[model samples]
Structures are given as C-alpha cells and as structure tokens.
Target: MRTPHVVVVMGVAGTGKTTIGPLLAGRLGVPYAEGDDFHPQANIDKMAAGIPLGDEDRRPWLDAIGAWAHGRAGLGGVVSSSALKRAYRDRLRAAAPGVVFVHLTGDRELIEDRMAQRQGHFMPTALLDSQFATLQPLEADERGVAVDVSGSPEQIAARAAAALDGLDATAPDAIAPDTTAQAGPSPL
Candidate 1:
C-alpha cells in the first residue's frame, strides 16, 4: 500500500480550492478541511469590508491551519488555503513538513469572473487583484503540483490527483518542478 500524504489545495480565491479540495479528498479517501474556517471573525470582517488582510492579520489564521495540518500528518487529508505568499507556505511547512500542495492556477479574467458570479462568498471580487498581486507561484523546491483551473471541478480535481500521483509520496520533498508548464492553456 502507498503511504498517504496530506494535500493542501492552494490558490487565489475563486480558483475552486473549496470546490476541488473536497473532491480531491474523496478521491484520496481523506478528510477535507475548509481553510477559511480557521480565520477569525476580524479577518473575515476585514475582507468583507474590502480590506486585504496584512501579513500580521494572516499569521494567526495560517497557524491555525498549520496546526490542523500538523495533526493530520501521515493520516492524510485535504485542506484549502490561498497560501499565496511563499512565507505563508513556509509557515505551513514548518508545522507539517510532509504536506504537499496542489496549486489551482487560472487566468486572471476567469478567476475574476468566477469570483463575481459566486454568491455569499466573504471574499469580494474587488479584492481579486490584490490576491493575484500577492500570489507567488510554487517554486521548484516546493513539494507540490500546479493544476490549471480551466475545467469542471471534477476535471480539475482529477488533474490535481493525477499530478499528485506522480509525486514520490515517501520522499521528504516530493517536488514536481515542471508541473505548472504541463497544466496547459486556459480555454477562455
């Protein structure tokens, strides 16, 4: 049997992290965690009011998610987070050293459209530019795959799963250096 590694479904808001995380977890037979649930009311309020959260505001939230990821170590699980900045991902790695990331990448226009169309999400479409500005694509040294978000949720999840399957799960750093290039083009 293959060893199970926890997967962090990461990307900018509206890239379908919430949608894809659960499906990927089902495929992997692991529990799914909504990263936004870790946020304090203040953080939510800030975003809802069109304010982007600063690093100081995000530290506690990231720590909470990291704690959850740390607890799920070896048992396998899926969790969603923007994890846009390298520093945030580094913080997560500090807590759960073996966690692998699945970055859902998409075109700015598509992501903005999705955000605009979605209802009741605390993250406003107005904040999307800031999100794109903050995102740092997964680096070569990172243990992760970058899956494009140009398909249905099921298709994207499948792609993420297939990319993850290519990783050597037992290795400490299961890096996929060129997976981003392999994800292909945006349809719209």
Candidate 2:
C-alpha cells in the first residue's frame, strides 16, 4: 500500500525472477534491482563451476542486496531479490520494512526444464537441485503471497501486479475446498 513498494520475486533457480522482476518494476514505474548483481565474482565462479552456494557464500551477497533494496525503497524505488530462506527474507525485511515479497513457486522438474532451456546464463542446470534442496518456502503467515508459475510470463507478472496493487477483484479459483466431510482434500 506504500509508495515505491519493494516486491521481492523469491524462489529457487528457474522461478522467473530475472524475467519478471524488470517487468514488474516497469509496471510499478520504478527501477528493479536484481539480487544476482550483488553476487561477488567468487560466487559467480562457483555457480559457473556447477557448485551450489552455501550460506557462507550467500551472506555477503544477501546483505549487499538487502542494503540496496533498503536504500532504493527508502528513496521511492522498488527492488527484487531471489531471497530463498526465511532468514534471508527476515534480513530483507529488517532492511526494508513492509516490503512485499511475491513468491514464485514451481515444481522441480518444471523449473529444471526452465534452467536447462535458459540461454546465456552463468548458473548451470546442475546447480538447480542444490537450490531446490536449500530453498525454504515462504511461510503462510508471512506478509506476502505465493503464486504458482504454471502460466506464461505475462500471466505471472500480471498476477504479481494485481496482488501488489489490489486491483485484482476476482478471487483466484486456483483451488476449491470440499465442504462435505466425505470429500477428501481438495486439489491444490
């Protein structure tokens, strides 16, 4: 609801953060910062070597990204990050309070296919598994929404903007709950 909202596009690799971040920023009429840009050369090299980045490797990067996000938001700008952990999210929150995170969730196979098909990216497909394994999905109680990456990039960006702007009136019928006790769990 605040001006220059920071909407983080968080998820494991291949979740479309890089693609959607700029589009979302454009929609919001603000600059979008990619979290990957904060990564040092060493981290990039390790990822290029098909090695997963551990917490130690990510701490400085996350801090730098968070600092940038905080600074930008303070100056009426929006930023995006692939913050994969609750702790990392907390760090960003600490830096930019009330920043809304738009979590992009997808299946391993789906995202793996995306990574494999991706062109001119330093992150190799081999590191996808490690990212998935280390990823901690955002909590349901968090101040953010989870959107499944089951549609086109445009659809995903629209959903993110709608959620952020409160312009989406119709509820997403992505799932239907069963009222009858006999009915089993509704398909999510």
**Candidate number achieving the greatest lDDT relative to the actual structure:** 1
Q: What would the per-residue lDDT of candidate 2 be over residues 1-188, giving only the tens digit for each residue? A: 33555677888889899988888787778887877888999999999998888778877887787677667754544555667777777766666664667889888889999988999889998887778777788786456778888889888888888786662233331212212312321111
Q: Would you list the C-alpha lDDT of every candidate in the order shown?
A: 0.86, 0.73
Extract clashing residue pairs from model 1.
none
Cα TM-score per model: 0.89, 0.82
Q: Where does candidate 1 stray beyond 4 Å?
A: 169-188
User: For model 1, how does the per-residue alpha-carbon lDDT over 1-188 read when each residue is reduced to its tens digit?
Assistant: 15577789999999999999999999999999999999999999999999999998988888898889889987989999999998888778777777789999999999989989899889999899899899999998898899999989999999998888776554544433233323321111
How accurate locally is residue 52 in candidate 2, as Cα lDDT from 0 to 100? 85
Superposition TM-score, candidate 1 onto the true structure: 0.89
Q: The CA-based lDDT of model 2 is what?
A: 0.73
